[model samples]
Target: MTKDTIIQFHNVRFCYDEVCAINNVNFNILENSLTAIIGPNGGGKSTIFKILSGLLKPDDGHFSLRKGSTIGYVSQFTDFDLSFPITVLEMVLSGTICKKVKPFYRYKKSHRDKARNAIKRVGLEMYEDRGINQLSGGELKRAVIARALASDANIIVLDEPDSSLDVEAAADLYRILINLKSDKTILIASHHLDEVIDIADSVLYVKSTVTKFSSTEEVKEKLGGGIII
Candidate 1:
């Protein structure tokens, strides 16, 4: 119950049919810090994100967000149907719904302004008015990030944001994350341990369970000589 603790998982467990996706997971996420959850694919990373984002309910145990806390999540998926017409700005503006404004009401200027700021933060200001179909893979990833940012949530979750980007695009993504760490509390599930270790204040290495949770230095030492989930 520390003042800065924003999230906690108490003996959290999830089962898919008969297979255990997560077992006895327990951890606390502090406010205003970046946490990297690193593990192999199919190791339940997406399952955990789904649970946190309220897309799924764990079969057992509990995960709690501090009172009044709100979260914005962008998944690792980018399999968008490009032909589905939607502009980048419009997509980002969708995040404004989190504000709980009246339904069917036209978005105010403030909403558009905030969405634009988020677009600029992701370096997509020039493409704001363009159809999402026009964006490259990397650009699409950043656009999703902008959508999350526009939500104005105190906590943000990003799952494998660097999955298919080229080295330069991935580097740019990291830069935006670095700038964001100063304000928003961020949780990321990434396999790029070497790249994220430097920026992450803490790390959670999971393999159907939490294998390690500690400062970056300590976790690196614990994982020395090899990287495996």
Candidate 2:
């Protein structure tokens, strides 16, 4: 791998229950670059994200990261039990805790401080003490992002970050993400065409049987009239 390459996937193939999710995918994500992955629903975008985050292993082929690379991931929103008692601060702190010790260990003060700064960076300072269940949809998303930031990772991956966010909220989130681009490589799987184009240094278009990687303008040209926002 070149010094610039932070992630490399060579002839990677992944399947789920005998169905192909990704096929012979070969790509590289450069260090400190912002890459956006876009595709139609059921196009295996999330599956690819899972692989990069180490949540799932590829069925065949090789995937490697630069030595000592650290990754942080924020998943798409899903239904959760509102009754589960956890504060936003506690949730963000959990990311730091997970990195330091096994799941059974208690959180440390340094973890709490890192979480607090992450919350502040996302402009959710006042909501730190609020119960996660009490947050608005946008606020909840911000909390999750804060948690990812607290991971102190060399790479950050986010799945469907714009879902359920209003225009202003989405813009705010994008600003925060842009600010983060200088510190680490960022890979986001999103269908928000306008947002992706605004921030992306590269774009990865995933299909059931093929994956294409290119710059935003190149992808737009390759897709022709299909590049609608």
Candidate 3:
């Protein structure tokens, strides 16, 4: 079966203070598939993400998402203060802030149900009441993912989600992502491809530009040497 194109970038170019971050970038992302964005440091992966997340506008060319689509973005480094007094459930509930009507100081019953369901989906049902700081690294990452889910996003974009996780935890994280791939379009940016290459349906190699490869083997062969994310 052929999947619909959920996102498209045609000769897209983005810059920051006269410094070109990504140029002549073009790619099509299929719906309900997992795409891994892999590249070296300072290679414009972050810039591409910013553009997709509506944080930055392209200086030239065109970028488009399917109409009525919503994006849920998880940054490489979360700015949330873990030390703050916030429970996992509360954090997930915050994801629905954008959906609240006027006088948004209070949340409706539907919002709480969504948050609780999201936590369960991520396998954090038991930790819903735990303080963010008290959870392990893997557990905390799951909480963040739950927050994205609670927002009712069909497209989920994650940046270095496996960062700082141990080998076992990283493997587990990929398992969770693979499970979610059936219902959501998943995009992940990582400096290392070893973790995601096997699970990703396609690979986007970005280095001041973008190219789509069907598999890791194709990317490695094109480079003509060892695999380098």
Relative to the true structure, candidate 3 reaches a TM of 0.93
Residue pairs that clash (backbone atoms under 3 angstroms), model 1: none
Better lDDT candidate (2, 3) = 3
TM-score of 1: 0.93
lDDT score of residue 49 within candidate 3 = 86
Q: Go through the candidates in order and give each one's C-alpha lDDT.
A: 0.86, 0.84, 0.87
Q: Tens-digit lDDT track for model 1 on 1-229?
A: 5899998988999998999989999889999888888887778788888899899898899999989888889886755677978999999998886446667878789999999999999999999999988998889989999999999988889999988788899899888888888888888888778787778888887789986556777877778524644
Q: What lDDT score is found at residue 183 in candidate 3? A: 92
Q: Model 3: per-residue lDDT, tens digit, 1-229?
A: 1249998999999888988989999999999999999888888988998899898999999888888778888887567677999999999999887654666378789999999999998899999999999999888888898999899888999988888898888888899999999899999997657668778999998899998998778866775434665
RMSD from true fold, candidate 1: 1.9
What would the per-residue lDDT of candidate 2 be over residues 87-190, giving only the tens digit for each residue? 99988987786555566688788888999999998899999999998998778888898988898888989899888888888888888888888887999888
RMSD of each: 1.9, 2.1, 2.1
Question: lDDT at 198 for candidate 2?
Answer: 63
Q: How many residue pairs clash in each candidate?
A: 0, 0, 0
